[model samples]
Target: MFRIETHAISLVRRGLMAALIVAASVLIGATVALAESHGFAGLEGGTFAMGSGKHYREEAPVRQVTLQPFSIQKTEVTNAEFAAFVEDTGYVTTAEKDLDQSDYPGLPPDLLKAGSMVFAQPKDPVALNDINLWWRYVPGAQWRHPRGPESSIEGLEDHPVVQVSIEDAKAYAAWAGGRLPTEAEWEYAARGGLDGAQFSWGEDYDPSEGWKANTWQGVFPSIDTAEDGHHGSAPVGSYASNGYGLYDMAGNVWEYVSDWWIPGHPTKDQTNPGGPSKTLAEQFANSAVGARHVVKGGSWLCAPSYCFRYRPSARQPAERSLGSNHIGFRIVRDGVN
Candidate 1:
């Protein structure tokens, strides 16, 4: 009788263990789904005017682009969300990894440390043509240590996580069961149903309307009036949402898009045109210093006199391997369950 009872108990324990495993799996699946869908705005995509002919040469030759339906996060990924991903996966970002010596032959040892480019505002107005006057490569500057090794994201949890490279953004998106949006998708969503507006909000851009987006309010790379109450990166959703209820689509940090960078858009209409697939070397005819991907929505460093690219049609090329303090990303989901 004792042996029989012991066997029964053992069987019961096995069954409980199996049941717990099943329950844990279900909970995990649910959690992943929640993470993917949370704070996402579904966009019913259609053909919209892409690029601007009036602004910079890169944005010239406006054309129509049709995109399939997709869902995008309401705001750029926040530091808290990225922190959770890092905590769960123990992932290390590109900026945190040591540089390959071979890539920087003969470079100074100190300059080869793990770090990222940060916007160091000059004390006095400097030449905007030379971005080097403001952008500095600081050692130990990663996403968590945004400003530098000494600076932390202590009070900036809600702010968009910066100093993340395209690869880093893709890893976080994969962990969350999503992917980076294409250039076409990002521009369409940034438009927020208003097809050809100058800014994300509308044609007229008057700060007296209470700063529609977080952009440089004073001299570029020098004096920031902080008229919008943000010296650098502002917390996500600090301003009003667009027509589709998406916030910070105009300014905050430049967002990464999947399409490779080309100088300008094709004039011909396109249906979800992902940029040219030729290798960066081939695309640039061997003139490019490095491979670059398109980053949209501009950043807080954008100013009227210097970088006035905080518009739906504005776009910029960022090196695929580099991460700057003014750059971050949002993710997108597609297809029905």
Candidate 2:
């Protein structure tokens, strides 16, 4: 009789454990739903003229690209939204984790500590040719502590979270029941229904038309006059939304997209181009040491005289593992919901 009672208790224990797991899953789903409700602008996708022939060579060979309908976040994900995700999953960001020795083959042990690249504004004018003058690999720089160990996101809850690597962004998207938008989708949405337009808002960068986006008003790296009422990242949706009702698609931060970087776009028309499918070595000169992924949308660091990439067609390659102060991301769903 005692043995029989013990077996019944064991069965009860297993049942209770299963019940707890189901409850946890329900809570997670609810959290993600709340996160998604913040506003996901839908696009009934069609063929748009992608890339630019007038600007950077990387955005050259403009192609007629087609896409399926999709829904994307109206604004970049904020610190509060990311905080909820971290609280739910205890997720650790890439910059917070110790560097793997294998990734940095020749690096010294002392340099393999947790860190990320951060943009430090120079007090005086610096050389524009080399980026090393303004950008630094700061130890303990992560999304929560955006600047360094001394900084925190205490009051800037609404600001878009930065210093998140592509891997980190992907993890957050998965948790939120979405995925990173492809470069094609990002540009399409950024264009805001204005095909072949130079800027997301229109053809000109006229502040007289109204401060459409948060970008550098003065010289980059050395000085920011803040004519748009922002020296750095402003709260998400601080400015006017585009035609599709998407905010901050042109500036404020450079967003990560799910595309490996190549020098130029394809010469022919295509449907749902997922970037090149060639091996990493073939695409990046057969060298795997510094593989790069496409980062779209220029940041506050962009200036007309230096980096005029605050347009829909501009693109740049960033190291896959590295995160920076000026880089953040938004998410997209497969279809409009």
Candidate 3:
């Protein structure tokens, strides 16, 4: 009787384990599908309308951009989303890589120490021109620890991932069988179906009355009144989404575009103008002097007094090696799922 009972117990344990594995896989797939719910369903004329503003005309114009047709994550790849990827691939991010002091000229001994920078509500005012004011060089703010080593995403599974380097974004895309969106594709999708209008919705910069894209809520740098229900970043889809169902296209963390920093828009109608052949490793007369890469969308920190890239056409240059709290990226997969 004892021998028979032992064999039965073993069979029951194996069956339970098999059931748990099946349940876990199903739960994971559902989670991924839920995450991508906001991306473009299709490309067609719709409610959103963009106009050739100074920024648009300067960088992009009415041109033919033939996309191969790909599915991108509806919003930025959030902290929770990145954590999942890191846990699975055991991938170490660029910031996680140890930079040899010999590589960078002014890199301080502590600078080479492993960690990333994150934005914090400064107890005092910081000069926007002087980056050190707002960007805190916090140790342990990687994918797992966004705010700091002590911080966690316990309940914020949908907040856009920040402090991710281009290298980090690229690795996640590769692991997901996807890649980064080109500047053109990012613009097209962000436009949603809106024709030419000043902003994503229309000419005015109102977040109410059908223009719920992300923009400055209160005063630029000094004060964020949180008028539209967000002081920093609202939930992934807290505000209204563009026609393509993508949210936080305008104000949030600036997104990484595949193209390098190249002056001037396309002179001719083009199909995915593969960005600049080489990125300019020159000093930006405006921002920090370092490797230049293209960034789209204005972050929550943007205000009239400071950065005002609240339009889909607006673009900016970011240092490649630098990953700020206001910078992140989404992944794109060629062909629909």
Candidate that scores best on lDDT: 2
For candidate 2, give the lDDT. 0.78
- Across 56-170, the per-residue lDDT of candidate 1 in tens digits comes to 8888889888998889888898877787777667677777766556765556776667777888889998875566677777889998789899998777767888988788899
The residue ranges of model 1 lying beyond 4 angstroms of the native Cα positions read 1-38, 278-282, 285-288
lDDT of 3: 0.62
For candidate 1, what is the lDDT?
A: 0.77
lDDT of candidates 1 onward, in order: 0.77, 0.78, 0.62
Compared with the true structure, model 2 gives a TM-score of 0.87
Better of 1 and 2 by lDDT: 2
Ranking by lDDT: 2, 1, 3
Residue 287 CA error for candidate 2 (Å)? 2.9
- Sorting all predicted structures by TM-score, with the top scorer first, yields 2, 1, 3
> Lowest lDDT 10-mer window, candidate 3?
1-10
TM-score, one value per model: 0.86, 0.87, 0.78
> For residue 270, what is the lDDT in candidate 3?
64
User: Compared with the true structure, what per-residue lDDT tens digits does model 2 show for residues 31-70?
Assistant: 3554665679889999999999999888999889999999
- Which residue pairs overlap in candidate 2's backbone? 281-286
